[model samples]
Target: MDMSERELHETFLPPFKATVDEGVASFMTAFNDLNGVPCTGNQYLFKEILRDRWGFGGMVVTDYTAIMEMVAHGFAKDLKHAAELAIDAGIDMDMISEAFVTHLKELVEEGDVSEEQIDVAVSRILEMKFLLGLFDDPFRYFDAERQQEVVMNPEHLKTAREAAQRSIVLLKNEGNVLPLDKNTSKRVALIGPFVKERESLNGEWAIKGDRNKSVTLLEGLEEKYDGSRVEFTYAQGTTLPLIDRSTQKVSVTEVPDRRGFAEAVNVARNSDVIMVAMGENYHWSGEAASRTDITLPGNQRELLKELKKTGKPIVLVLFNGRPLDLSWEEENVDAIVEAWYPGMMSGHAVADILSGDYNPSAKLVMTFPRNVGQIPIFYNMKNTGRPFDAEHPADYRSSYIDSPNTPLFPFGYGLSYTTFEYANAKISSDKFQSGSSLTASVEVTNTGDLDGEEVVQLYLRDRVGSVVRPVKELKGFEKIHLKAGETKTVEFSIDEEMLKMYNIDMEWVAEPGEFDLWIATSSADESNHLEFSLVE
Candidate 1:
């Protein structure tokens, strides 16, 4: 209505679009703030923004306990007001938000809301329940026989192992120390408090995940190791870091008190090659788990440093949710594997990778910093009016003085035993009309002795926008495989939507101008840049 309040209008709409493209038609709203406002009864999420703009006619379900939390959110006058606002806003059903079922009918009778709206919402909720086949037998999912039959099926275990292997980012390897020979490791030492613990393997949000059923790294090694030839030794070393909270009363388990840190250091001295399984316990990540100090907790850091002085080759295996401070390990450790809580099959996966049965191809999704002060470091950065160039640091550029503005281990950083090279990238056109498609091709060659896979990432920068754009945007990506000494030509189609930049009015438009296409190995720029145009 007014230009002065134009920015406020955009706020009335859903700031982030729900992932409707994922083929999930049912209601799946997060319980918390979506763009700084509660999402449970958010009108922007259901009626005006979702259905009107995104065409999402799917069920709008309440977040867990959100229908009730509205009293705390202060949006509703009472339980009845909460139900009416949510239902009138197009919320069809409630998931653990009991206010809807309790007051929906009463509101309809009083004419505060209508039965037609209630029925409409209830119908969509039932439709999803029908799709899930829950109506046939609501208790079928809880059947113990069915749970036993499907739980950790052989195929699921295999998948868990594969996912584990894929998630293990080899952070550091010096002098070709990884992929150890199974025949050579006659006496192996798995010295860590986590090696036998079951609770740490199953990460947070893991509903119904059996901790007792999990095979720890020590257990996995003992089960696989040839008893006649191979010997296994495990020390109850320091406890790893658990989640840190500034407000909550913290219970720090005395890692050094559990076992003498000196004893563990001595154990490392005698082992053939030390495999130090370290990092945070499961409570450190996921919901409500933010961190101030992202480093090896307890006495683990001191233990590692002391163990390094023993002149024994060390392999570091880290289990964490987000990236951590690993500058010393990256520089010192002979080998490092970033296994983000590999689930029930974590132990077997580590053994497989160590025994050279599986070749890892996991890449870093977030940045690892030198310290906590350099946190929130990710792949994407905004181009300031003055950007930094190392060659010309004195040009009043965009950078930090004390520490480099870059991350220690960048986004898309990963390792395999093999190596790959990219060449011969070509784009089909310099210009594209609205709703048209553009093709970009490239040749990827695996130069190492082992076969592996690489994820080809495509990024775009919308220059001359009515609004500001990130330095680079992850428009498209594809994973490809290559054989040793083999080269394959890969192509990705660039849709017109890739060129659409959000205007000051929040309208997506492909303005007529030159657009730059960046074909890279990761989210960050890897090799070369290609230019193209988007015509009217």
Candidate 2:
């Protein structure tokens, strides 16, 4: 949330620069202080960087109550002082704070803030309104007729279902227990608190969504099969507690009732295949919702243990916003589906993936640690001076004594219904000039029986630079689909810009050195690699 000037410019600022390049209409200042200064009142960030360097002509808005919080942050004398600092620093609008409305005029009159600065801020806000056509017709986006026609229409629902299906990430599939035979006459048991939760399906951000219209996993399963052929039973194995975000506390009344645990076990025993929909409810993982423990909550894991004793195939379907500590589930569960709050068509998408109507293709964008102890672990992390040496364990190099120093799932990690094999990578040239481009290519073959899409990732490491660099960084990626036994070569073009880094002098330049490039499935899977050199 916060970083030094160099780290901010080198890492966090790139995406913001890209957004400005695309002509985004507005930008919001962060709530946290960047370095030492509060982001809402940072002159360096607003004036020197965003406005002057990036040439962002858009309006800069403060996050909710950020201006007022500046006083709480001890940076401002009071609400009036906060408003003056924010305006002079380039914030155009105060969101929910009303600091500007209460204090800006007085500040200008007192000669503490220039009237010209106020005019500039007001001009940006008016320009955005003009661009949005709100000046001509304030009700342009508030049409009831348009809302009735477009909202939750058939086309929109189809797109939502398709998008939900694509968003799913299949975490584990032991012996290919998933894609169960829909035609077979089998008892399919769907168990958990999340199975029929329509209101929690959209998660926290969907404040205006119609919860009644959203389909649940139970509803989707029923629609997928004929009632006569397939038997579906649902049991609320555990309940989730309602959390108070501000206080980080739960009510005694909201504590889960484990009375349904025995019923869930009984249902699992009678079923041929079990799908346990387990995870944090809508309240457990979003904004302001921090957890000291990242494991399955309440009696959810105990419920799974009871279901597993039935000696039937069990698939765990998770629905949480953040990465969970699935070390136990990873060992016991036959298969796992990460159906992260799949919105309006949550049920349909889960049914599709479970029934094999759609092959799972989405990759995990963030790294999943083995436990909370590895909280800050990431793929692009730099190798420290005494990095963990597996071969020489007694050397006392950097490592965890209790657990292995590796993530449960590395960044860019995902699985498809079909398997893909990566061959040795090759490059167009051994050496390229600073201004020239080099091509890296690798052959990927669909080795499994099913056709599927794979996201081929390209990563590289500068062997040596003026300053230490990350072990590897993702440069480019492409998603491609192939039939079974088909082989296709994926290529990525690399130039000096792609390899450039902020050196000791903080100048973005590609130093003359060898680069080790890998073209493979994920950051951890670096078996297929090639080397190249950059010339002056």
**TM-score for each predicted model, relative to the true structure:** 0.89, 0.97
The alpha-carbon deviation from the true structure for residue 276 of candidate 1, after best TM-score superposition, in angstroms, is 0.7
State which candidate has the highest TM-score: 2
| Regions of candidate 1 where Cα sits further than 4 Å from its true position | 1-19, 34-36, 142-144, 185-188, 223-232, 241-248, 252-259, 432-435
C-alpha lDDT of residue 125 in model 2:
93
Query: Highest lDDT among the candidates is held by which one?
Result: 2
Q: Lowest lDDT 10-mer window, candidate 2?
A: 244-253
Per-model clash counts, in order, read 1, 0
Per-residue CA lDDT of candidate 2, range 1-536, in tens?
A: 65655677767889989889988889999988877789999999899999999898989999989999999999999999999889989999999999999988888889999989988999999999999999999999999999999998999999999999999999899988888767778888889988887888898888899889899888898888755477888888888767765566765657787799899989998899898998887877677888878888777888888888999999999988889889989999899999999999999999999888899999999999899999988898888888987777766688998888989988998888889998858899989998999899999999999988999999999989888888999999999999999999999999999988888888878899999999979899879889999999
Model 1 scores a TM of 0.89
TM-score of 2: 0.97
